[model samples]
Target: MEIYIVGGAVRDRLLNLPVKDRDWVVVGATPEQMLAEGYRPVGKDFPVFLHPDTHEEYALARTERKVGKGYHGFTFHTSPEVTLEEDLARRDLTVNAIAEASDGSLIDPYDGQADLKAGMLRHVGEAFVEDPVRILRLARFAARFDFAVAPETMTLMRRMVDEGEADALVAERVWQELAKGLMESKPSRMLLVLRECGALARILPEVDALFGVPQRADYHPEIDCGDHTLRVLDYAASQGQPLTVRFAALGHDLGKARTPRDILPRHIGHEIRGIEPLSELCRRLRVPSDCRDLAHITLVHHTKVHQAFELRPATVLKLFKECDALRRPDRFRLMLDACLADARGRLHFEEAPYPQKAYLESLLAAAAQVDAGAVAAACDDKSSIPAAIDAARTDAIVNAREYWQRDN
Candidate 1:
């Protein structure tokens, strides 16, 4: 049997990137032969085995036939006669189709090396349309490598989207790709690529609707809601924020898309109006609770957080209670980070200071020092304990705000 290292390991290595995982493709090998050689079979839809020692995956050389629709529609054919070239041909991108033989010989049947050097993303073959997930994967690769998509490949992606392949993608896979893309260095590229191919409208219409929507240029400077969202997402990524924070940045301004035309560029009450669409997005994708919660809090309270200095001490204390900042400070900090990303994500405002985040943090810290347990103990009646705690926190916030103002 002939074995070769394939896919991302080869691609990343060629780019001088740190290879995280290595995938293997074994040509001229049957499942029975693989088992006899001590490789454990792990694939359900095809012949994939794991090495007994390294535990890395080794999939047999195979070809796929598109039977129905979406990613799961493909049927696999694996045989000892299957060539390494045939297996490589079934891959999504040309850059990813390169293979390295056991003896360190490189194989580039589709001219993947040329495209890799040119920093281009191009399809390997016509089989690219057989799987809809390729569209998401290509967009994600654009975000990762900052590579330009070949025009013909983009045309092919648009055709696939037009043929309803994008709609056939499953919820889990959509969320998976989107989450991965959000964590990439230039997540804005992923969104813009999906938009260019019209897959963004199919998969995330709420986000797509924001593209042409107008926003007040005095505040946004970008003048487009979609542009603002992209900036926010990229800012979150550039700050090395976690997935939850990045997700929140992406969803924070979704309500702006639903603004009434009579209001023109103003998105007043968009934060509250954003709840329905954002909730639907999270529910449809079956998004993880932490991501969903952080996004929700950022969407609903971001404007309030930005207006922190204008809010009364009691109002600030109430906001803290609603956000549960004292109990779940990490998530609260993530929400603030998302708000900070939004603040910095406008035209010529990339480095703008977000004093509100620090102000809120200071207020939260001061209120948290109020000793709720002691306040509850001192309350004369059980019914008044909640009020007593709130009063103490409000007073603490008042003092802290005055101190902060004086210091600033």
Candidate 2:
């Protein structure tokens, strides 16, 4: 068997990036031969094995044919006759189609090196349209590598979307790709690329509706709600925030998309309006509870967070209770981070000071000092326990706010 290093490991090394995983393609090999050589079978659908020594993935060079619709509707053909070139041809992007021989010599029959040098994301062949997941992968690559998608590949992607391939995607698959893209360094690219190909509207219509919608220029100097959202998402990614924080930043302003045009850009009750769409988006995607809860909290209460300095201590304490700050301080902190990102997401405000984050965090900390157990014990009656605890926490919040104001 002639084994060659292929896919992302080869592509990343060519671009001077740190290679995280290595996949090997075994040319002129059968599953019987692989088993005879001590490799362990691992692939469920096709011939894939784990190297006995390195434990890296090794798949027999295979070609795929489209047999039906969506991502799972593919038939993979593997045999000793399948050439490495044929296997490479089935890849999604030209830049990912290159392979490396055992002698370290490069193989670039599809000119993946050329496209890599040009920083282009081009489809390997017309077969790219067969898999709907390629569009999500391409968009994710755009976010990760900061590459420009080739016009022809984009055309193919648009065709896939228009042909209802996007609709074939299951909820978990979309979330899987979206969550990965959110963790990338430039997550906004993923959404923008999807938006360009019309898949964003197909999968995430709430986010898509935000693109052309206008925001008040005075507050959001970027003017477009979509632009501002991207800025917020990029900011969160830049700060190395976790997926929950980044997603909260993303969905924080969905209500603005529902703003009545009759009121122009005011969006007087947009925070309240945001509840339904964001909830529906989370439910439809089957999003994880951590991400869903934080996104919702960020959407409903981010405005309250921004106005923290203006509100009374009772309102501030109410914010802490509503966010469950005492019980889940970590999530509460993530909520603050998303709100902080939102505050800095406007034009000419990328580095603007958002004292609101620190301010709210301090208030939460102050309220958390309340000894709930002791307060519960001191309560004369069972139902009065919650009220007593709230009263104590409010007093603590008042003192903490006074100290913060005095110190600042």
Candidate 3:
């Protein structure tokens, strides 16, 4: 049997990127042969094994045929006769279909290396339309590598959407790709690509609705809610923010889509109006609580964050309490990061200062330092203890704000 490195390992190596994991295609090998050679079987749907020494994945050479719909609707054929070229042909992108032999010889039957050198994302074959998940994967690769999608591949992706293949994708798989794309260096490209292919409306309708929705031109010179959201996502990525923060940035302005047209570009209550759609998005995707909570907080309280200097000390204290910033400082910081991204993601505002972040952070710190136990102990009546602690925290924030104003 001849083993060859394949897929991401080969793709990343050719691009001068770090190979985090390696996958192997064992040509001319059976499961029985792999087992006898000490490889541990792990794949439930196909023949995949783990190396006894390196523990890296080693999948047997196999080919797939589309049977029904979505990603799971596939039949796999694996045998000792399956060639490495056959296995490579099943990959989604031409750049990912190339393989390398044990002797360092390059195999490029589909001209994947040429496409990679041209920074192009082209499909491997007509079989690319069989799997709906490839649409998301291609969009993600566009974001990750900043590569241009080939016209033919994009036309095929659009055809997939028109033919309802894109709609057949499962929610979990959609979220998986979305989360990975959000953490890329320029996630807006992913969203734009999906929109171009009509998959955004199918998978993320709330976000898609923002594309043509108008925003106040004076505040958002971009004048498009969807465009603003993409800018916020890119800004979050530029800050090296984590997945939660980036997700929050993506969902932060969803409410603007529901704005009343008579109001024109003004969305007076969009902050509160956004909660329903954001919650729906999180629930539908089965998003994790941490990401859901941060997105919720950013959507609901971002206006407060932007108007931090205008709010009263008591209101600021309430903001801290509502966000539970004392108990979860890291999430609070992420919330601030999301708000900062939103504030500066508009046209001509990329470098705008967001003093509100530091102000609120200082206020939270001061409020957290207030000794609740001491205040409760000093209260005259037992029923007044909670009120006394609240007053003390507010007073601490007041003092912190005064100090900030004085220093400035």
Candidate 4:
């Protein structure tokens, strides 16, 4: 049996990216052959096996056809007769179509290496429309690689969205891709691409409504709400932060649209309103309950950091207690990063001649020290630690030490 390593592992290796996971494609290998060779069958939809020793995934070379709608409507075809080039040609993006033989030689039937070097994302062949998910996948890939989508592919994506092919996508799959993109190094770019192509409205009509919604120039001065959100995403991604942080950054201002505008630039309780929409979004997208809960908490707490900055110790502890009671640190940090990203996106801060970055750094450093459980307990006690909250600052060193201790 001849085996070849394929897909993301090979693509990432060529790009000098860290290979997070590896998948192999075995050609001319039957399930019987795999069993004979001590490989275990594991896939229900296709011929996939687990290596006996390394426990890595090994799948037989396969092809797919669209039998219906949505991401899951495809039927896979696998046989010893399918050529590597034919399999690669069916991929969604050129950059992901590269393969490596067992000897570590590269296979580039569609010039994936050239496109990778060019920082471009292109569709492998005309069969791109067979699956609607490619539109989101292309956008998500662009976020990951920070690469530009080829003009032709962009045109195809636009056509697909315009033709209602995007509507065939389920909310869960769309959310899956969106969450991954927001977790990437350039989420805003992906969002803008989606916005430009009209897929944003299909999944997040609430966010789409923020497009061109006026924000007062005195404070915002960054074009509009949509532009401001994009800035936050760009800033968050630039920091190389974690997934939740980046997600919070992209979603921090999502409440602004629901905020009352009777007064100029007014968004009183917008954060509160934001929680429902964000939660509904997560539900619609079929996100895991834990992640959805975090996203909801992130939305609710977006305004807390700024509000807590000047609180009395009792009040601060009470606030901390409330968040701690929820006991979701991942969600809290996600909100904090989102808030920080929004603050950094202000026109004044973006062009500042001052050390705004340093100030933010100091704030994050100080805020890190407050324990979520301690704050939750304090808030639950109803005994205001207003003084402590007012004086509280995150002690980065202490927090880091604590983190290390927990791991140990």
Candidate 5:
């Protein structure tokens, strides 16, 4: 059996990127041959094995034919006689179709190297239209590599959307790709590409609806709610925030999309209105509780967070309670980061100072320092203990706000 390093390892090596995982394609190898060689068979639908020594994935050289619909409707054929060129030809992208031989020679049957050098994402062949997931994958790769999709490849993707291939994608798979894309260095590009091909409306209608929605020009000079969302997501990434924070940034403005036309640029209660769409999006995608909770908190209270200095101490304390900030300080920090990203994402406001973050931090710290047990001990009646603790926390918040004002 002859084996060659293929897919991401070869592609990343050509681009001078750090290769994180290496996949091998085995030619002239059958399942029996792999089993005799101590390789562990693991693939459910195809012949994929784990190397006995390295334990890395080694899939048999195979060709796929579309037999049905969606991403799962492919029939795979693996045999000792399946040529490496044929295997590469079935790949989704030209840049990922290159293989590396044992002697370190490059195989360029599809000219993957040329496309890689030109910073292009092109499909291997017309068979790319068979799988709907390829559309999401291409968009994700665009976000990750910041590579431009070739016009023909984009045309094929648009055709796939038009043919309702994108609609066949299940919510779990769509969210899987979207979560990966959101973590990329330039996640906005993924959404932009999906929007270009009309897949965003099919996969994430809540987010897609924001594109033509308007916001006040004075506060959001970006004007478009969707553009503001993308910018906020990018800003969150720039701040090195985690996935939960980034997800919150993306969903923060979903309510604006449902704003009344008469309201036009002013979405007075959009923050509260956003909760429904955000919740719907999360529920439909089966999003994890951590991400869903933070996104919901940000959606419901982000404006209150931005307007912190104007709020009463009791109101600020209530904000902390509403977000469960005292119990989950780390998540509270993430909320603050997302809010700062939103404030800075607007036009001509990229570098604007976010004193709200420091102000809230101080308020949280002060409120957390209130000795609840001491307040309980000082209370005359058992029923008054809860009220006493709230009063002390509110008082602490008032003092902290004054300190923040003095320090600034």
Candidate 6:
């Protein structure tokens, strides 16, 4: 008759991490009994309900079986006889399997607390392979915890990928898991894990192709495109930017891999070419429209912003006009950092032509805060708002005054 908080909320609480979500396991309860208790039924395939007073999720102990293919293909069984231990055992990673009993006692049926203490991520049971979604889940767990996956668990994941089990994963589930991983404290490890398990090839062949592609010795002498990408990912993590920006940082140079080396030492217009593919890639992966727009801005403005030193006021304004609505300042900043990181990692960059820090800083400052609507309003004026000219002293004064008063 006791209801105990369980799953991620409990695990996160034990780790001293923020417990953002809460769920409970109701022992000695049946679906009919829960309904009679005023809990609203929610899970069509399992005995999950919402508590009447708390509105928190409450599920009767349940077990599931693979009914068919893909992540949705599961048959769940629930009964009053099922124990909490049985439910925890079916979870993907051990660190997430521990539950908190109603008395605030730690429940470690799978030794998940030990794994958590040891900074490891282990599969709950052999039943892990019952769903291919677990592979991405395991990778995401590593990103979130900065923990390494156990070797045997990785072996199981690789087998899942090689056995065609991963093919059953739908685009939506794959992207959802990947976006979550991308938002983690660090995503480089996630990519590394994905690549090691052959999941990257299935998810993004273009990025996988970057693995061994050689850049001209004059520009890149350290490693192939892929290794440099990993360094960029590391930089993105170090900078601690948000997920959308991080995705842009990871994808910024992806088109370089698709360019022909016959052009040698140069991949002209690669930025333009990269955009279409990147857009399609995001769409196919089910990236949210808002995030996809940020990715687009990174691809378009990356090269344009680099050339800002040579740009006329009109051109610069046009660039901002094109991107101002995207609300991706963080993405743009990460793109600059990634580009700089890539350059520093390449041997040829030591002596190659590079923008002076002063000039780059000035350009970045100009781009820092753009008034998209004001610029558009100015553009529409027939009277003589000079295109992309410096903000007039009068306009600057009025804007600053408005901002100050608004804040006050």
In candidate 3, list every pair of residues with a backbone clash.
none
TM-score of 3: 0.98
| TM-score attained by model 4 | 0.79
Task: Please list the residue runs of candidate 2 whose C-alpha ends up more than 4 Å from where it truly belongs after superposition.
Answer: none
Error of 2 at 188 (Å): 0.9
Q: Each model's RMSD to truth, in Å?
A: 0.9, 1.0, 0.9, 6.9, 1.0, 6.3
What 10-residue stretch in candidate 6 is worst by lDDT? 356-365
lDDT by residue (20-80, candidate 5, tens digit) is: 9999999999999999999999999999999899899999999999999987999999999
Q: Rate the local accuracy (lDDT) of all candidates.
A: 0.94, 0.93, 0.94, 0.73, 0.92, 0.72
Model 1 poorest ten-residue lDDT run: 371-380
lDDT of 5 at 288: 91
Alpha carbon deviation, residue 191, candidate 3 (Å): 0.4
Winner on lDDT between 4 and 6 is 4
lDDT of 5 at 390: 90
lDDT of 1 at 198: 95
TM-score against native, each model: 0.99, 0.98, 0.98, 0.79, 0.98, 0.80
lDDT of 2: 0.93
Please give, for residues 115-220, the per-residue lDDT of candidate 4 as tens digits: 9899999999887988888888888888888899889988888888888889898877787788788887778778877887888888677778778767777768
Q: For residues 1-408, could you state the per-residue lDDT of candidate 1 as single tens digits?
A: 999999999999999999999999999999999999999999999989999899999999999999999878989999999999999999999999999998888998999999999999999999999999999999999999999999999999999999999999999999999999999999999999999999999999989999989888789889999999999999999999999999899899889888889997998999998999999999999999999999998999999999999999889987898899989887898899999999999999999888998899999999888888888888789999998899999999999999999999
TM-score of 6: 0.80
Model 4: CA > 4 A from native = 259-269, 288-304, 307-334, 348-408
lDDT digits (tens) for residues 1-408 of candidate 3: 999998889999999999998889999999999999999999999999999999999999999999999989999999999998999999999898889998999999999899989999999999999999999999999999999999999999999999999889998999999999999999999999999999999999999999999988999999999999999999999999999999999999999999999996999999898999999999999998989999999999999999999999889878888899988877998999999999999999999989999998899999889998888888889999988888889999999999999997
CA lDDT, candidate 3, residue 10: 94
User: Local error of candidate 3 at 404, Å?
Assistant: 0.3
